[model samples]
Each structure stands twice: as C-alpha cells, then as structure tokens.
Target: MAWIILLIVGFVGGTVGSIAGLGGGIVIVPSLLFLETSLGVISNMGPQIIVGTSYLVLIATGLSSTIAYMKQKKVDFNSGFIFFIGSGPGAIVGALINRFFETDQFAGVFGLLMIGISLLMFFTKSIKPIGIIKTGKLHTYTDENGMSWEYKYSTILAIIICFFIGILSGLFGIGGGSLLVPIMLLLFGFPTAVAIPTSMFIVFLSGITGSVTHVSLGNVHWLYALALIPGAWFGARFGAYLNRKLNEKVVVTIFRLILIIIGFRMVINAIIG
Candidate 1:
C-alpha cells in the first residue's frame, strides 16, 4: 500500500516537474517526508536520505524527459553541455557540504527563492540576452504561429550562473530548473518551448553528478528509488507531450502560480517544523 502511494507520488512529481522543468524534487521530497513522518508508511528516514533518494529519482525523470524532448528536437545540446560543465562540479560540492547545514534553516530561504522567482517571472517581459563575450551562441525557435523567437547568451556568464544553480540543485534536489528556466527565459530570452526542454537536458546531466555524491555518502534509499523510477520515467514522457500542446504564455502563467503556492507551502512547513 505504501509502495502504491509512492508510485503515485512519483507519477505526479514527474508530470509536474517535467511540465515546469522544476525537476519534480519539489514533489518527491515533500511526499516522502509526509509518508514517513505522518503516515508511518516508511521508517528510519532522515532529510539527507530523502534528498538523496530524490536525486536518484531525478536520474529517471531527467533521462526520460531528455530523451522525449530530444526526439521532438526541443533540446539545446550545445547549451545544455555548456551549463553542465559548471553545474556538474557545483552539484558535487553541494552534496559534500549539505551535511553541515541545519536543513530546517533553509526552508525560509528556499521559500523566498521560490516566491522571488514567481514575482520575477510575473513582472518581467522579454528582453535581449546579455553577452559577456562575443562567442555566445544564438538560438532560435519557431512557434506554431510560425513566429521565430531568437535569443543569445554569454557562455562565460551562463557557466558562472549555472555553477551556483548546481549547488542549489545538489543542496535541494531541485534540478535547478526553478532558477535556470527563468534565466533562460528572461535573461537569455529563450522561448518557452526551448527553455523548458533545454533545462531538462541540463537537469539530466547534473543529476548524474549529484547522484554520484549522494551514493558515495550512502544517502540514497535504493528501494524508494526503485519505486519512483517507473512512474517518473513514464510520467516525464507524458508531461513532455502535454507541454507541446500548451501555449507559451499559458505555461509561464502556470509556472508562476505553482511557484507562489510552493513558496507559501515551504514557508508554512518551516514555521510548523
């Protein structure tokens, strides 16, 4: 019965995360805690273990979504790789240092981060991307309306920003899309279609690096990962399908609302705990 619940959690997490490019840890981590602490469906769990388990689940979610998006030609492989170069190391560092912080202390900060992201997305309009170096690449996407959206970014700047995001990903199991997607959208002026799929590609790569650290630290619960994998894999594919059907503006609106709700929830949970 607990396994069944967890499978459902995975499905929901993957679906939402894939749609939003938020990496589903937002759902997976919280649900696992609810199961363990509230319902007693699982036992002997700690926050670290839950985080580790979440990253393990990300492997499946990221890989599945990356494949699906790639097939649709939605993924930006060059940009993804560039971002991963920085994020990879950052994730490892975050995992190694995660043990030092009082996990609850971060709840308020995380909450604020989410809230701020929502506000930024809500208030901002499309703008030209900054290029710290002339070597940055230009990416373009054509929407169903036959409108082609073009964006560019600096590789040096992106790498720097992504490294920090990777640390956050490692620390929070967030897959960094919550932060990366917005930057891609606003700072880099990437289209909704391009930003989300490319974000998933980065999530997949960083998940590998982050999971390695978690595994070495014995933070993962393999059984839980096993339960989450099938649901997450299939759900991600489904989410990718859904994404293709939605309007770009609609997707951004959904992203904003979700952030606000999640931010409020995180703040409340922190206060209660």
Candidate 2:
C-alpha cells in the first residue's frame, strides 16, 4: 500500500514539476509525510527519509529530463554550468547544516519553510530583472550559438543568486527549481522554456550532491525511491506536453495553487506534530 501511494505521489509530483519547472520537492516531501503520518509508520524518522528518498528519485528524473531537454535544444549548457559552478560548493555547506538537525526538528522546520516559500510564490506579482549594473537597463544579447542571453544583472549577481539557491537545495534536498526558475525568468529575464530546462540541469547536480550527503548519513531509502521513478518519468513526459499546450499565466496560476496547498499541509502537519 505504501508503494502504491508512492507511485501516485510520484505521478502527481512529476506532472506538476514538469509543468512548473520545479523538481517536485515542494509536493513530494509533504505528500510523503502526510502518507506516513496517516499510516502511523515510524513518523519520527519519516520526514528525513522522505527528503532523502525524494532526492534519490529526483536523480533519475533529472537525468532523464535533462537529456530530453538537451536533445530538444532547450538547455543552455554554458549558462547552467556557470550557475552550478558556484552552487556546487554551496550545496555541500547546506548539506552539512542539514546533518546537524534532529529528525523531528528538521521535519518541522522543513515543513514551515516549504509553506512560506509556497505562499511567497503564489502571492508575489512581478519581480523585474536585476540590471547588469545598479543603474543600467536590462539588456538581451545573442550568443554564438544564436541562443538569446539576457544578463539583467552582472555575472557577479548571477553567481550570487545561484550560490544562494544551491545552498537552499542542499539544506532542504529540494531541486531548487521552484526557487531558481522564477528568479531566472523574472530576474534574469530568461524565457520560460529555457528556464524550465535550465532548472532541470541545475537540479541534477544539486540533487546528486544532496543525495550523496544524505547517503553518507544513512538517511536514504533506496528501494523506496527506485519504486517511484518509472511512474515519475512517464508523468514528466505527459506533463511536458501539457506545459506546451497551456498558456503561461494559466500554468503558473495552477502551479502556484498546487504549491500553496502542499506547503500549507506541510506546515499544518508540522504544527500538529
């Protein structure tokens, strides 16, 4: 029954993730916790296991999705590499921090954090690009590959943002897509399609780094994570198709609502527990 529930969660999380450009951590963690709680299956350690397992499953989804997007010319490899160059170190730091918390405490804090981020994503309106300079206009440039580049801010600013996002990813075992995608689109002015693939690319390494860290601490549930990947992959493909068919605003609205609900549930559970 738990395996069956995981498959359902995987489908829901993957579909929503594909559409929203998040790796689905926002939904995955809460859903697992809720399921574990309802079943009364060692609730104390369930949250940590959920985090570890989600990242493990994400490794599969991220690799598959990244390859698919790269083949379609959706990913900007140079840009992704640059962003992740700084993020790699940050992830390690975040993982170290994660290891310090007790299971129940981590779960509560993690749940509340998800809820806050979700609310922010839902309510926040337009956040304009940060300029290359404090006073400069947002500029778009074409690269040698004919890919469009918008460096609203300086390279330094971009690096800073990536570093912070990476830290968050490591700490929470999230893919950082939920946070990175919006910032990339709204702040860097990257196109939605580009942002989606880039988010996947970024999440790949972050997920691996976090997963490795969790594994070292004996927090991962390998079999459980493996069980959900097939369903997640299929759901991702379907969700990607749906993403192309929907309007951007409508997609975002629905995605935000899903985030809010998941976030709220996590917060509520945290409080109760």
Candidate 3:
C-alpha cells in the first residue's frame, strides 16, 4: 500500500516536474513524508533514505527524457558542458559531506532551500531573450561538426549557478534539474524547448554524482528507487509532450502558483517543527 502511494507520487511528480522543469524532488520528498506517516512506515532515517533513493530514480527518468530531447536537437551542449565542468566536481565534494548530517537536519535545510526558490519564483517577473542570444554585435558560430552555437553571459552564470546546485544535489539526493531549468530559461535566455533538454543534461551528470555519493555513504535504498522508475519514465515523456503544447505565459503562471504553494508548505512545516 505504501509502495502504491509512492508510485502515485512518482506519477504526479513526473508530470508536474516535466511542466515546471524541475527534477521532482520538491514534490517527491513531501509526498514521501505524507505517505510514510499515513502508512506507518516510521523510521528515523526515512527522509534521508527517501532523498538518496530518489536520486537513483532521477537518473533513470532523466536519462530517458534526455534522449527524447537530444533526438529533437533541443539540447544546448555548449552550455551543458560548461555547467558540467563546475557542477560535477562540486557535487562530488557535497556528497561526501552529506554523511555527517542527520535526516531531520537535512529535511530542515531542504525545506529552507525550497522556500528560497519559491520566493524567487514569486518575485521574478519578466524573462528577456534579447541579450542572451546573438544581436548586432553578437554572431552565431558553427562548429566543424555542423552544430550551431551562441555565446552569452548566461553561460557564465550557468557555471556559477551549478556550483551551488552541486551542493544542493549532493545534500538532498536531487538531480538539481529543478533549479537548473529555470535558471537556464530565465538567466541564460534559453527557449523553453532548449531549456528542457539542457536541464536534462545537467540532471544526468548531477544525479549520477549524487547517487554515487549516497551509495558510498550507504544511504541509498536500491529496491525502493527501482520501484518508482517505471512510472517516472513514462510520465516524464508524457509531461514533456504536454509542455510543448502550452502557452508560455500560461505555463509560467501555473508554475509560479505551484511554487508558491510548495514554498508556503515548507515554511509552515519549518515553523511547526
């Protein structure tokens, strides 16, 4: 029965995450806590274990979505490469440090981070594409392999953003796709299509790094993670397709509303705890 609830959570999370460009942690963790309490699978280690196991699930789901995006040429490898260069190493370091903390503390920290991200979503207004792409002074370049590229300040910002994202990924067992996609779209000026693919690429690296860390720290629950994979994979693909059909403004509005709810929940939980 608890497992069934996890599947439902994964299904819903995959769909919401696909539309919002998140890795699904914000949805998954809260759902797990609620399910665990309802189902009486009480364990002091539940939160940390859930987080660790979720990253393993993220790898499978994220990998499939990445392939979907790559085949469509929606991935921006140039930015991905730069972000990877920074995040990969940072995640390794963060994962190693995670072994020192207890689950309750980790949950508190995760909630705080979510609250910050949610507030940022509420306050941030317009996203401009002008400077992030080639204008009169900027020009697109083509590599020998025939792939086209545009250089922008957003690429530099991506590297900086990944540094912090790496720490969050390691600490929370998340792929960091939640933070990566929005930053890619808003800060880097990537289109929705391009941001989705690039965010997936970032998730691929970050999830693997965090998963390895959790495994080494003996925090992972392999069986549980495996159980959630099938639902998340199929749901992710379906969600990705739906995202393409929505209007940008409508999508942004809905996304912000979800963040607000999640954020408020986190803050309230923090205060109560």
Candidate 4:
C-alpha cells in the first residue's frame, strides 16, 4: 500500500516535472515525507536517506524525459554539455556534504531556496530569443515541430551558475531544474522550449553523479527508489509531449505556483517538526 502511494506520487511528479523542467524532486521529496509520516512505513528513515533516494529517482525521471525531448529534437546538447561540466563535480561535493546538516536544517535551507525560486519565476517576464547566432559561440536550431530558436550566452557565466545549481540539487535532492530553468530563460536568454529539455539533460548528468555518491555513502533506500521508477518513466514521456502543446507562459505560471506552495510547506514542516 505504501509502495502504491509512492508509485502514484512518482507518476504525478514526473508528469509535472517534465513539463515544467523542474524535475521530480519537488513532488517526490515532499510526498515521500508525507507518506512516511502518515503510513509509518520506513519510520526510521532520516532526511538524508530521503534526499538520497530522491536523487536516485531523479536519475530515472531525467533519463526518460531526456529521451523524449531528444526524439523531438528539443534538447540543446551543447548547452547541456557546458552546464554538466560544472554541475557534475558540484553534485559530488554536495552529496558528500549533505550528511553534515540536521534534518530540520536541511529542510529550512531547501524551503528557503524554493521560495527564492518561486519569487523569481513570479516576477520575471517571458524571455525572447537574442536573434543573433555566431558560428562558434552561438547557434540556432529547429525543433521537430518546426519552431526555430536562436540563443547566445557566455560559457563561463553559465558554468558558474550551473555549478551552484548542482550543489543545491545534490544538497536538497531536487535535481536542480527549478533553478536551472529560470536561469537559462531569464539570465541566459533561452527559449522555454529549449530550456526545458536542456535542463533535463543536465539534471540527468548531475543526478547520476549525486546518486553515485549517495550510494557510496549508503544513503539510498533501493526498494523505495525502485518503486518510483516505473511510474516516473512513463509519466515523463507524457509530460514531454504536453510540453509541446501547452503555452509556455501557462506552463511557467503553473510551475511558479507549485514552487510557492511546496516552499511554504517545507518551511512550515521545518518549523513545526
């Protein structure tokens, strides 16, 4: 019964996450805690273990979504690669450091981060393409649906931003997409379509790195993570499909609302627990 609930949570998380480019952690982490508190299954599980398990689940979610996005030719491989260069190592460091915080301390920090992201998303305007494509520095591409996009950004700047995003991902087990998507859109000038898929790809790499570290530390609960994978896999593909059909503004607005709600919940949980 508890496993069933987790599977359902995974499906919902994967669907919303793929569409919003926020990854499954936003739903998976909190839902897991809710289940544990309500069902009393895994009552001994600590927050670190929960976070580690979330990273494992994210590995599956990211892979499924990336494959779907690749089929649509929506992924920006070059940009993903650049972001991974910094995020990959940062994830390892974050995972290693995660054990240092108490459960409530981690929750407080995660809550604060989510709130910051929510506010940023709420106030930010839609991003437009820069419209200039340099041969080596900037590039233009068309998606499978025939929409074209062009973008230009500083590689150093993106790397620095992604490194911090990876640390937060590793620390909180949120897959870093919540931060990455907005930064790519508002700061680096990526289109919503491009940012969604590219962020997933980067999350895939960073998630794997963080998961490995957690595994080495024996922080992962394999049975729980395995249960989440099947639902997350199918849900991610469906969500990616929806991403093509929905209005970008609508998607972002919904994403922001989710962040605000989840952030508030986390803060309250930390305060009361």
The number of the candidate with the highest lDDT is 4
189: Cα error in model 1, Å: 1.2
lDDT by residue (tens digit), candidate 3, 1-273? 656766777776666666555766667776665556445653444655777777777776667677766766677777777888778777777777776765456656776777666656544345454454343223244543576655355455557779888877766766677777666556555555667767777777777877887787776766666667777777677667776677756765776666667656655665576
Encode model 4's per-residue lDDT on 68-124: one tens digit a residue: 999888899988999998898888888888899886777777778878977877755
lDDT of 1: 0.81
Candidate 1: where is the Cα deviation over 4 Å? 106-109, 124-135, 247-255
Lowest-sum lDDT 10-residue window in model 4: 127-136
**Model 1, 53-103: lDDT tens per residue?**
888889889989999988988888998999899898999988887766554
Name the regions of candidate 2 deviating beyond 4 angstroms. 41-45, 123-125, 130-153
Error of 3 at 236 (Å): 1.2
| True lDDT of residue 156, candidate 1 | 84
The local distance difference test score of each candidate is 0.81, 0.70, 0.67, 0.82
Identify the runs in model 3 with alpha carbons over 4 angstroms from their true place.
37-44, 123-151, 154-157
* Models ranked on TM-score: 4, 1, 2, 3
TM-score of 3: 0.82
TM-scores for all predictions: 0.89, 0.85, 0.82, 0.91
The residue pairs in collision within model 1 are none
Q: What CA RMSD would you report for each candidate? A: 2.5, 3.6, 4.4, 2.5
The TM-score of predicted model 1 comes to 0.89
